[model samples]
Target chain A: MAEAAGYDPLGAAGTWRHQRAKLVVYTLLCLFALYYVLPLGVVILNSFRDLPDINRNGLIGLPHSFSLNYWSLAWDKFCVGGTCAGIEPFFFNSVSMVVPATIISTAVGAVNGYVLAKWRFTGSEVLFGLMTLGVFMPGQMVLLPWARVLGWLGLTNTTSGLVLIHCVQGLSFTTLFCRNYYVNIPDDLIKAARIDGAGFWRIFRKIVLPLSPPILIVTVIWQFTNIWNEFLFAVIFSSGTHQPITAALIALSAGGTSVHQYNVESAAVLIAALPPLLVYVFGGRYFLRGLTQGALK
Target chain B: MAVEPVTLTSVKAAPNHGRMLRERLATILPQLVLAPSLFATLIYVFVFCGWTIWISLSNSSLLPDYSISGFHHYVELWSNRRWTIAYTNLFLFTSLYVIGATAIGLLLAILIDQRVRAEALWRTIYLYPLAVSFVVTGTVWRWLLSPSTGVERVVHQLGWASFKFDWLVQREMAIYTVVITGIWQASGFVMALFLAGLRSIDPDLVKAAQIDGASMPRIYRRIILPAIGPIFISVLVVLLQFAIKTFDLVIALTGGGPGIATTVPAIYVYDLMFQRGQMAEGAAAAIMILLALSLVLVPYTIWKNWRERREAARG
Candidate 1:
């Protein structure tokens, strides 16, 4: 078996055979990439086109002219729900919901994770396991009861209500992330601090918190993206002025029974998507690492 | 100093007591930190699930009732036409979405592994969809696939007047539009996982195969794919969980329309519980979803535990 084949099967780079293969690979990749990119491109392009142009040029055709009318309308004038105010107010609501939820959830997860990873007590693993199981639970499973709970607390239809639900739900994932990351930290540092008469909080503040920026980045990015894009809870719990970008996006796009305004809908979609899009672009590897580890691990 | 000798034992005992108290506090601190999350999870996951079970069993309507009852709602749920359509769609969508995402993801990963230029650009292009909310994906895809205004209209305008891609409006073909959007959204995630798996494999394996007259496809089939089998299972588990809980996408994309053609269990659960105010039947539908998730997740948990034990034993 070792002596049968003498030549290199892969061949040198840029050889004719390899070139043909390269062409095929690039072509296929470009085609699929276009599949993903074209819709987005169309959204951006169509966002600039006025309603008349969309009707004349078709949704995918090159714009004969461009205008900023749709973006402004989507942001400032387009009616969402009963409010004639545009997505701007809902954008603020989402920020109000997402910021607190992300910070609070990540903080809770970090503390829980630090304890679960470093300060292991009896049945700690079982506790951790149960928490992780919450991550897999479908939102529908908890929706009705959670809503009742929120309503009982008089927090329903408030940004704070959305924050509370997201924080509660996000804990499992944040805990999982922080705990897994902390597992790789050497135990000796903790023991050394313990020998020096440090307690749990002191050691965590001094030793663990400093070592946490990486996991915190992962957790925050994950939570922010999730809470921002969340629809079901936001739609059900919040109404009127408190709806987030996602829920508002739905109301805006599906607002009219009249002819669907492709331009305004495209603009609204892009506006709602902008924050997460920016995060994905800038957060880069942290986004991928967070999602992959969050899913697979 | 000499007079202090009698008090030395008491003094030492005092410090010892303080130390013991401090140690006990340290021991309790972790549990205290962990208590909120534990309590939340217990209430949210288990208690809510239990609540749904109770509600499903009761003859509750619009509001929860305390009296215990039989599986009347479950029976009704099973008999309902909408519920049946939703149940069938779950299986159809899950299978197609999972299979399509996995296949495309693996294909993209293999192509990108061939030392392609601009790898980062390609990866970003693919993975960007994962960041978009399902709401957005649904809306965007709805626009793209709509018959009168989307691709069909555009293609027709491009001078192929006979083109007919109106799956969004057709009752029978409506669900497949969801399948397409689901794949478009998830294939990038699948590809990322497969690419990670591919990158982790030793180059020597490929080299060895090449030296032995093995073609690229043969090498992938025999060696590369088998080695990454766990990733495939992981991807399937993830995608199935996604499929089972898919509501936002369907809601935004089709609104479960063309008259109940694209209803999944999640949408079904939401409609009965929230929209129709049929609390008992909705809880029944939700439990069905929980069971569907369990069908994938229970074995997954067992497999994970088994693998951990095996690894521990090896160590």
Candidate 2:
């Protein structure tokens, strides 16, 4: 409304020129929106099309015949390894990896954030700054050494290993998220709790923890989507039965010596992409809020 | 209940002890909670980075032998033609992708800022790609760009018989196809950031500019754009690091293929370590990638610190 007021006084005072410009702007926005939507749209439509029809009519064409075969095949029969078992196993791997990683990272991050916000030690700010540095550190810097470290610990090629890796890597972002959210909680409430002879954990348990649902939701959704969609770590660290859907999707779609099964690939990618897509559809505002918090300030 | 006589020293010492205990716990509590994540960062980021640096200088291969060498891997990495191509591709992709993503994102952000209807729907449509993995993004784009079943086929069906959009298989221009997909995936994310920045700008400033008889474009150019300059830098730094670490996208899309046309340092590092079993050289390439990241990140950090200091000073 304020933005509307700012522009309403001089420009677009009910003129033909203004209407024309408005049409152009709306058209461009629609076109860009379409551009962003087209690929996913193509995938969704192609997922239902039979393979032969897809090859005949191209990606954007109307399906000559629709088949749910690809989805069933993707779920039951797409082969990434020697077994012809579908992406079902890998999807479960992603779930197992994502759920625990999200919970652990979010819990650890909440405590870290609480302390960083409320209980400032001598070097806490310095520590916080150092942790923030992890956010910008490229995964390339640690991939080789990390693989070696995981092997040394005998945890390589396991879901737990991937979970641990994600939880650790996720600390920077989740802690930052929780810290920013907790920073806005009034200090008086915390001080009052301190006066009531409550210890640190007690205050957090009774007061701060109750106030954490919004940030927890944001952090969980963020970590879930991130871990679910993560590729680099999953590819290098997990193989065979342990690979997450992201890695498995790559293998199923284009990895190894296999025929390029575009229909199956489309269905599997849609399956791979659907969880986060649903989250965005339902939790768009929260997702946007988390992003802006992490990215902008 | 009988009142007991309490010594002054007893009362004084009791509260003092309580205070001291509380103070000590306060000092130690945060460290206790923070230790796990800090330890993880220490091992994963700092220690591993140091290990990488050391390995880069050593004669490690296949199984990571720990003999100290003198930059042999770096020398070899630089001299290899494939490495040269990957390195060049890194810069090329970074520049084009950063510029393209930022431009398109800014354009979309501005377009969306026009008080449009279905704002949330538009935002969702534009932003959904960011939720999908790069692997999927690359795979989908690869399929869409393939000649037999993709853009070329569709356009040819539409009677543009000469239409040929086969950059996915071309050697000279394959990198640009990666750039295209990168832009497609990321531009919306950047747009979200820019839209947030645009929304946060004080509307009063825009009003003042409008009252000065400036057109909307002029007002934006002279007023709004400069106000949100920091966001552009932030987006650029973030995208720059992304560009440096690009691996899965290029792998799934191009597989560094058509004769290694789309190879980047990340892929090269992966190939060396995992595929070729050249651990030391891979570590060396990894370090180089870290160096490239630091080049962007270090300056961004300094700029942020300076800006924070300036804001504090102003306050």
Using lDDT as the measure, which candidate wins? 1
Tens digits of per-residue lDDT for model 1, A124-209: 99889889888888888888788889989999899988998999899999999999999898999999999866888898899999
- Model 1 chain A scores worst on lDDT over the 10 consecutive residues at A1-10
Query: Could you tell me the lDDT of residue B14 within candidate 2?
Result: 56
- In candidate 1, position B215 carries an lDDT of 76
TM-score for all predictions? 0.95, 0.94
Candidate 2 residue pairs in clash (backbone atoms < 3 Å)? none
lDDT of 2 by residue, B61-145 (tens): 8888888998888999999999999989988998999999999999988888887777777877889888888988999898888
Question: Could you give the fnat of all candidates in order?
Answer: 0.66, 0.71
lDDT of 2: 0.85
Q: To one decimal place, how large is model 1's interface RMSD in Å?
A: 5.3
Tell me the lDDT of model 1 at A181: 90
Interface RMSD of each: 5.3, 2.5
Superposition TM-score, candidate 1 onto the true structure: 0.95
